[model samples]
Target: MSERENEDRKIPASDPVIRLTRYAQVPILAGLSVAMVLFLVTFFVDIYDAIQSFEFLDRKKTILLILNLLDMVFIANLVIMVATNTYNTFRLKALVQGDDYIQQGEKAYRRMKHRIVSTIIIISSIHVLSELLEFSQTTPLQVAALLGFHLVLLATYVVTNVFKSSD
Candidate 1:
C-alpha cells in the first residue's frame, strides 16, 4: 500500500466523541423523515379530497388547493434541507457538493437560518390565503393578526435575502 493511503487509514474510526456526535443526529433525521412522510400523506389526501369533491369545486377552493400544495412543497423542501444538511455536516464523509457549500460555522448557520425563514414565509402566506378565503368566518381582529404576522415574515424574508446577497 502507498504511504499516503496508510496514513489516511490511520485516522481514528472509533473515537467516542465523533461516534456520539454522529449518532446524535439519528433522532433528528428520523423525526424529519416522519414529518416528510406525513406531508406526503397529507398531499395525497388533499388530492383525494379534491377528486372526491370534483363536482363541488369553486374558485376559492381551487385557489386554496393550490396554495395548500405549495405550502406542502415548501415544507418538504425545509425537511429535506435539514435532513440532508445535518447528515452532511456531521457525517465522516460528506454526501454531495452542496454539502461543501453548507460547511461549518457562520456559513452553515446562515444557510439554516435562511431556509427556516423561507419556510416560515411560505407558511405565513398559506395562513394569510386561508384567512382571506374564509373571511366570512374570520373576525376583523383575526384578519388583522394574520396580516400582521405575514408582514413580519415578509420583512424578515426581504431583509435576510438582501443581507445574504451582500455576503
Candidate 2:
C-alpha cells in the first residue's frame, strides 16, 4: 500500500454542488410539496363534472379521462421528484451504499443519473398526455411541434444523465 493512502481524507465544504444543495433542498422540497398538494386537488376536479354529467358538459367523458391522466402524471412526477432529489441532495452516501443494486458506489453518480432520467421521463409523459387533451382541436402542425419539443427534452435528459444504452 502507498504511504499517501494513509493520510486522512476530507471533502471540502467548498464543493459547489454539496454546499448549494445543503441550503437549497429545504425550499425546493417545500415548494414541490405544495405543488403536489395542488396536483392532488386537480385529481378531484371532476366531481362537479360527474354530478352535472352530459346535461351540462358536451364532452365531459373526455375531460374526465384527461384529468385522470394528468393526475397520474402529477403523482408520478411528485414521487420521483421527492425520491431522487432527496437522495441526491441529502442521503447521497446512504442511498449509494445501502442499495444492493448500486454496486458499492463504484459508479457513484450512475444511480443519481438514472433517477434523474426517470424523473424527466415521467414529466415528459405528463406533458404529452395533458397536451393531447387540451390541444384536442390543434392543427397537425402544432401537435407535431409539441411532440418535437417533448422528444428533444427526452433525448437531452437521457443523453446527458444516463450512459448510452447502445454502448
Over the stretch 6-118, how does candidate 1's per-residue lDDT look in tens digits? 76664434568856877889998998899888889999999899989892278878887888888888888888887887775665233332334335445776778888888
Best by TM-score: 1
Query: Which structure among the candidates has the greatest lDDT?
Result: 1
Candidates' RMSD to native? 5.1, 5.6
Output the worst ten-in-a-row residue range by lDDT, candidate 1.
92-101
**Candidate 1: regions farther than 4 A off:** 1-15, 92-105, 159-165
Q: What does candidate 2's lDDT look like per residue over 1-167, in tens digits?
A: 55655332322224677557666776877777777778666666665555556533547556646656565675656565555656554555433323432454435455556665666666666666666776766777877887888888788876765656632
lDDT of residue 85 for candidate 1: 72
Q: lDDT (CA) for every model shown?
A: 0.78, 0.60
CA lDDT, candidate 2, residue 128? 65
Instruction: Name every residue pair that clashes in candidate 2.
Output: none
